[model samples]
Target: MTSQAITPSHGLYREALPKGCIVFSSSEGRAIFREALEAGHMRCYFKMAEQFSTQTELTFCGLTTLVMILNALKVDPGKTWKKPWRWYDDNMLYNCVSMPMIKEIGISFDQFVSLVMLNSLIIKSERVDELASIETFRDHVTRLSRQDDHFIALSYSRKSLGQTGDGHFSPVGGYHPDRDLVLVMDTARFKYPPHWVPLTAIWEAMKPVDETTGKSFQTEIRIKRTQYFK
Candidate 1:
């Protein structure tokens, strides 16, 4: 369902949780990394906010994830053009797509793919109508993490991640095979922080149908690039 379809009981369309509430630890920042090491999952790693430029706007999660992935891969967006072009700038992205468009009609899988391709990133994506099983989802995430890549999960925040929103996008930073939990590095840092949630929870969240396409949301995998944007 689209964000517009959601009927908020109290007039607030979305729910927000304070940082550290989800993970509940004094060392909330290091908890995911420490747990990943203990569980023998792929070593937890991701670029921090300082590594990339992003606006503090609420609806730019998809764009934020795109910038995060690009920065993580060492693709200098600012230098990708002959002249200084901050194409990856959040404002540029928001202006390109428009805030009203994003709010009324969420970003489509094809639109997201085109955005990444425009930046010269190699991306492969698929839409799974039914997740099938937790093991299937777990294996997919684990494999990606092992290969030093991350999956951009398009999920219903309320259904899948226990958040209070319709659809959201974030990168899976790490996977804990033993605990059956996955680290969701949410780009909406102003509202929610990165946290480890049950793998099953994410799988369910991804199963919802997109109102725009009448099909399920998509999961995007970024492959190692052999060439960079000039």
Candidate 2:
């Protein structure tokens, strides 16, 4: 009989995990991650991923704005489309963050985001212009939980993250006393589903920062996961 290698526990796995590596224990955690992503928790998801991965700080305005756009669009992420999703340079940090990596891999930012978003097994909507507010989106998504949905399982390698910022927008994937970083992939170029580390999941202590120099910001959010109905 052949013996299977045993996987280590979270503590051992986490300590030995290389920087940027992601690990998940429970199917429930994975499911929630996917659902939160499809529901427009883009920034939140990224923050979570950062706990396990190395990351650079970004402006809050850009992050929050992206979330707002996604909330307004109200689209399904799982559905594939022929046309590329549209996002302005002013709103995204991809150029500043991923350009070096792309050059190393020989690709453009457009191509990178397109590839990542396309390869993502889970995605929300590209256009979310109808939602009245982030709070409204949150409320609306809360209602979506009662309905049936479906989702896919996909995983990828861990990676270091880079981000561009003008300091005018909300921060994404930044350090917070309440949150732990994890790898949350933005499969869509669209700004919805602020997916990242959930502060509440792996709780941390909070510290105060100078108001003028504080590197933190806030936005309203809503998340939904795919559901399977028999």
Candidate 3:
């Protein structure tokens, strides 16, 4: 995978992944995750896949990203949506951050944290700047991606990854240790597909300050929450 520098669309609907990036739908990308799955590096991938979904609105990246992670972790929203079942949904996630506000512009790291915690979900969010170093971000994700109890999501400047738009969020499906690639399961399905990006590239992408949030980008994980029941 050559590091081809190009401007990629944040929601690259029909755009191609950069040279070094591996498209998740492509055979090569699938094969890489398949190998990792067998190696026990993809436990969280299966859980995430079961609840994967596209953002309902153009600017609902954060809302979309959290919904997937919340459902993946199987955290019951503690409220019935259709009756007899309690599940997390995008609309159900705006308690702390209103849907109107999120649609106007995505949420910042702090906003995301409040929503997650308010929902009773445990989280560990670390901004790129606050981390010991980029390596710290890399190591944390590497471990989280391998486990089943928790899942990771990143809030970063889309432009840093050579993508269009502005700040965006998505979950990490798995990690390919040998190649040092992280699977980004972008929730904005209308634009981009799941892809494998170098770990360091993802780290660098998180270093930019979010003009909307007035803070540097960060990565967050939902530590497994209360078990769900019908």
Among all candidates shown, the one with the greatest lDDT: 3
Ranking by TM-score: 3, 1, 2
CA displacement after TM-score superposition, residue 5 of candidate 1 (Å): 37
Off by over 4 Å in 1: 1-21, 24-32, 38-44, 48-55, 78-87, 94-100, 103-106, 130-134, 149-157, 220-223, 227-230
Best by TM-score: 3
RMSD of 3: 7.0
Instruction: Write the number of the candidate with greater TM-score, choosing between 1 and 3.
Output: 3
The digit string of per-residue lDDT tens for model 1 on 117-139 reads 77757776666655455565666
lDDT of 1 at 218: 63
- Candidate 2 stretches greater than 4 Å from native: 1-30, 33-88, 91-195, 199-207, 213-230
Structure candidate 1, residue pairs in collision: none
Poorest 10 consecutive residues of model 1 by lDDT? 221-230
lDDT of 2 by residue, 1-230 (tens): 99999887654221232323233334644565555455544334332333222122222223333333233233344433335754322224343346454323333212323432432223332212332244443333233322323211111111211122111222232222223333233322232222344432211111112133342222222222322222
Query: With candidate 1 superimposed using the best TM-score fit, by how many Å does residue 120's alpha carbon deviate from the native?
Result: 1.1
Tell me model 2's lDDT, rounded to 2 decimals. Answer: 0.30
Model 1 reaches what TM-score against the true structure? 0.72
- The count of backbone overlaps in candidate 2 is 53
